[model samples]
Target: RKMKGMENLYTLHQEMGNILLSHVLIVRENSKLEKAMTQINDLEVRFKDVQCLDTSHWSNPAPSMIQQLHCQIQLAKIITQGALVRNEFRGAHYKPEFDLNQPKDFDPHEHVDFLEKQHYGEVQENEFPPGHLAYMKRFEECNKRWLNTTIAEYKNHRPEISFEAVNTSLVQPRPRKYD
Candidate 1:
């Protein structure tokens, strides 16, 4: 087998790596997300165009590499779509558009106990840093709306997306503090 599409596969891998680094890293926005999604669509088309050479009775690694490339394309589609839908700055996925400003007088030590507690404990607005109470309210609202597992399935030659509730029975989910 000549392994016809290896060149295309290598190019695709490089392009995809660049796209992910530019669009899905520390800062993301709708435009970047949309561009990434569009690139993934193009990748799908290019992937389908790859002619699979017959490997019956052949002893070579080309077939294995091609299969790995297919899996990589599928994973790229799922991840890009998932990141496109999420509208929050959480963990490693930071979106500048959705980022909230830190409270001017925030004291991490004063609120560490409540922040670590399950269910967030009772809040005393007066005790909070100037803007911290407002920040917590908005954070809670987002947590209620968007805290879940993103589920993607490969069907009909595309990724069908869904969401499932996260299992936080043992330890209630708490917002990650970077500062």
Candidate 2:
């Protein structure tokens, strides 16, 4: 998929990734996540217009890297947007806004439009409204709701993620009192 005017992908990818990386941590109540989402969305728009140097001639990797970068940009948005929707924290996904008591279920379809907007270069009518914003669970809670399969699938070009409880027939869920 070599396209003209794509020469800038390699360099562009590096720069965009660096900028997006800073905002990926910490799940604050609202504004913090809002700010990060804005950053990534802006980058998504800019990335679509990037031009690659056409590797078909020199067989350079710039074209391939550029393509990969484009996909990565969308992925960054997906991750950030997903984090924003889930109010609570589970396992490594923690936001100060929520604790173990508030473990929220992860919704797969929530961030689809954020990913969809990258194509239109503008917020489409069907896109999820902005400012609309997990689950927080203690270690003990993990054995029950979690400890199963975490699923991620792309449906209609959007991520559809769900969880499947682990078959505990062999090992029953229990509280670990390890000191």
Candidate 3:
């Protein structure tokens, strides 16, 4: 039984490699590999036999599960073909194929800017809520400290001047300044 299990595992790995190589080839020759990729994705979703909360005997399968199974079957048929396929590094699977050490063009202020924009959108023009401004100011002041504090440090000594506490204060009619 153990030997059979090992053989099955080995076979699965070989099949996976073959499928990947075939996908790479199809992608190289025909630019329209989206359909093929979609099918492969579908097959993967169905092949996964995990009994999640929605799929358990106690609970019925969701409507989406049927659609997922349909996609898996369609993709499996195309991937099993033995045709000579081209190989090229492209798409999500080829992440490690590119330069690993290159730093991402990250803007730390992007999230803050987005939050501010979202807040602005929610409020009417020239109708700046005093509470909103207070909250924003408090956020800006604590933002640096919040970023610097590690999860371990936070768990050990819960920060008195925390975002949650500050937000709760702001929601009230008269906000109290944290000591």
Q: Largest lDDT belongs to which candidate?
A: 1
Please give, for residues 38-114, the per-residue lDDT of candidate 1 as tens digits. 99778867876564455566685656767888788788888877888888866577677887665656554544554
Model 3 Cα lDDT, one tens digit per residue, 35-144 = 44554554454444422234344555532454454443444444332111212122222222221221133233433453566567853333343344444444444343
Local distance difference test, each candidate? 0.72, 0.56, 0.36
Stretches of candidate 1 above 4 Å error? 1-7, 51-59, 104-122
Candidates ranked by TM-score, best first?
1, 2, 3
Q: Which stretches of candidate 2 lie over 4 Å from their true place?
A: 1-7, 26-30, 54-56, 101-150, 167-179
The digit string of per-residue lDDT tens for model 2 on 1-179 reads: 33555336666667666755566665445566678677766766777667766545665776677668767876776676666655554545566654443213323344344334544777444343332121111433444545655565657755565667778666544322212
Error at 76, model 1, angstroms = 0.3
Better-scoring candidate (lDDT), 1 or 2: 1
Clashing pairs in 1: none
Q: TM-score for model 3?
A: 0.20
**What are the TM-scores, per candidate, against the unseen true structure?**
0.79, 0.54, 0.20
Error of 3 at 21 (Å): 5.3
